[model samples]
Target: MKKEASAKTWNTLRNITLVIILFIFIRYLFDEDPFNDRIGWSVLILFWTFKGLFDAVEDKRSGNKKSMVANIVFVIAGLGILLWQGIQFFLYK
Candidate 1:
């Protein structure tokens, strides 16, 4: 029961973080100098990447195969996107 409650709390936090990241990304799309916000964006992406990985671990512990797989995919995709963005920022800067 306690483990389930902890998992729920983490899930809620991850969801909220995802929403905030999305809003910041949308705002970045409209900003005049996107590169100026690279640090903020990088931090958000790193947070999201770690959150997904932690969720994957929780899902594995709970024997939730489907969710575990989904979280793993999210983590990989997030990292890939972050790396791509970092390269772009470095190359252009």
Candidate 2:
């Protein structure tokens, strides 16, 4: 029971981390000049992808239905934000 609780806690932390990374990624991806702002976006992408991927695996390991759904929503929304931000800049550029 204790092991299961820790697993849930870890999953929750990862889910939250994923949200933070996603926000950072979108914030950087909106740069008017992506080339000039490569470093910011690069860091965002690296960390976002890393955290997002990590949380996904952790969610699978935990096998908690509620947490899994929540994490999935987070991952989808985060990815959507990144895509939307990228598209907005691309269209304007």
Candidate 1 C-alpha error for residue 60, in Å: 0.8
User: Each candidate: what lDDT?
Assistant: 0.81, 0.68
TM-score of each: 0.61, 0.48
Tens digits of lDDT, candidate 1, 39-63: 6677677777878898898889879
Over 4 Å off, model 1? 1-35
lDDT of candidate model 1 versus the reference: 0.81
Q: Cα lDDT for residue 50, model 2?
A: 56
Task: Compare the candidates by lDDT and give the number of the best one.
Answer: 1
